[model samples]
Target: MYCSANGFPALVVLKMNGLEYLEDWTVEEGAMANLKHLKIRRCGNLKMIPEGFRHVTTLQELVLRLQPSEFFERVQENGLDWFKIKHARSIVTKR
Candidate 1:
């Protein structure tokens, strides 16, 4: 999914499922500006988190489940995609 700026401006929490074919998600700067919690499940094909997440300063928590181990690793502290979500206070991943 590709989200542009100002999309879902009032959104505080978002949950997505059945995205097995989704390879990536892009969030443009300022998109989901008010989002605090995000959950993505059943997205086994997703490769990585979008770089634009760094712009989502309001994001507080992220939860990823039922995804590939490599995908989950990318969100770890020393992982490649960590910078995208470092601002989030909590990140949870479950196989």
Candidate 2:
């Protein structure tokens, strides 16, 4: 949660398996501004990505390795496509 709200320039790698240690994605959205490669694993509690992520045009690769049954329980849940990223590396399902 220490990531700056303005923009995290030097932060590239983000691995959140035991995401229980931190808050939800909304609280960590600011840090994602300048991120390149992101790895989101085992965050079953997470519903969706943050809002400001649309501004993060620098992102390249993304790995979504976990999601519980209720991931889309509610309607109007904005999907990951809004990120508008370029050069997607890969999107693999662990199961």
Candidate 3:
């Protein structure tokens, strides 16, 4: 949410986990323009990545680890979350 600030720059790599009560996470347009790698681990309360995630053309890798069942399923090849990040060169998911 705070990443919506204009001065916010895309992170080359981001790792997040253990954030309970997290939902409806969203990133603003062009917020992560330079992001290349992302990792989400042990976030059982999260539902899905932001819709803007798809627009991060610079994103090259995405890793999901030890997440909720829904989060895992939704990121599969044809799942809802898949469409947002299908362009990423690599996507790894773990239960």
Candidate 4:
């Protein structure tokens, strides 16, 4: 899909069984600046996110399932500050 006309970005919830072909996501980090919400599920092989994913000021929520690491938690803890983001709402991990 494409970004909004205003270019304000979008909220995405990713739910993939595996991340074998997710290299494109890392490669296109710059272009996905408008992404707001990201949810990754069962991506156990995923080691890291795009470099600038932490700087996505428009990012609102980050959700992860089957991820048990400090890195992912750190991203959720430090990155995507809701207060700093005007439209950023909230992050919800797997329950």
Leading candidate by lDDT: 1
Q: All candidates' TM-scores?
A: 0.93, 0.63, 0.89, 0.52
Per-residue lDDT tens digits for candidate 4, residues 28-86, read 33445667676777666555555445456566776667664643554464553322333
Per-residue alpha-carbon lDDT of candidate 1 for residues 1-95, written as tens digits (9 for 90 to 100): 89998888999999988787899788899899999999989888888898888999999999998888998889889899999999999998898
Clashing pairs in 1: none
Off by over 4 Å in 1: none
User: Residue-pair clashes per candidate, as listed?
Assistant: 0, 0, 0, 0
Report lDDT (CA) for all predictions.
0.90, 0.55, 0.82, 0.51
Q: Compare candidates 1 and 3 on TM-score and give the better one.
A: 1
For TM-score, the strongest prediction is: 1
Tens-place lDDT digits, model 2, residues 19-75:
855435552445555677777777766765555555666667766665554543221
- After superposing candidate 2 on the true structure, give the runs of residues whose Cα lies further than 4 Å from its correct spot: 1-4, 21-23, 27-31, 69-95
Q: Find the 10 residues in a row with the least total lDDT in model 2.
A: 70-79
Model 3 residue runs over 4 Å out of place are: 5-7
Model 4: how far residue 93 lies from native, Å = 3.2
- Which candidate, 2 or 4, would have the higher lDDT against the true structure? 2
In candidate 4, stretches whose alpha carbon ends up further than 4 angstroms from where it belongs are: 1-15, 20-29, 70-89
